[model samples]
Target: DQQVKQNSPSLSVQEGRISILNCDYTNSMFDYFLWYKKYPAEGPTFLISISSIKDKNEDGRFTVFLNKSAKHLSLHIVPSQPGDSAVYFCAAQFGGNFGNEKLTFGTGTRLTIIP
Candidate 1:
């Protein structure tokens, strides 16, 4: 029932400050991970991703870190902005699932940036 978990339900951050989000997984078959941002009515959009082989990946103000031994991953946002406020979801994909392409996701963390 708890294959993947997002410890934080919500995060409040001040504009121009740093926002941290975390996730943990119990499955080792997952070889790829992704972060998605979703608005109220629209569909979730792909934000960024990292391979299990990499420890850290960064793009602009967003950075994702993966720790295999701890089965933990984190997303760091520096200088948080109002536009960045949204429900962020973390998803995982199993490797060698050649015929079937599906992603398992952890509960999303709603991020609020105070302006």
Candidate 2:
């Protein structure tokens, strides 16, 4: 069964604006969450991550917010740039240490930054 979902298959954002990508999960057992960005013909690269204990995490232009009560999470990119365009994936892990956790990934969302 598909436990994670990204409802929006694609999103477009103007450069220099904020881009919000959303995801939802059906599995409440998941305790750790992560975001990855993939470029064409390249592997998905880790972006940001948040633990189940925290509501939000930020790094540079990227931020991830988790709403445990609703089983929802989002990635926010501020001042989006053309280089930020990519396919974004949201992942969850349950019951393991960070280094060894098995991650479940959502269907990716394609984000395009319009210049």
- The runs of at least 3 residues in candidate 1 whose Cα sits more than 4 Å from the true structure, single-residue gaps closed, are none
Candidate 2 residue pairs that clash: none
Off by over 4 Å in 2: 97-100
lDDT of 1 by residue, 13-113 (tens): 99999999998999987898999999999999998898999999999999999999999999999989999999999989887757545878999999999
Candidate 1 lDDT for residue 96: 79
lDDT of each: 0.92, 0.95
How does model 2 fare in lDDT?
0.95
- Cα-lDDT of candidate 1: 0.92
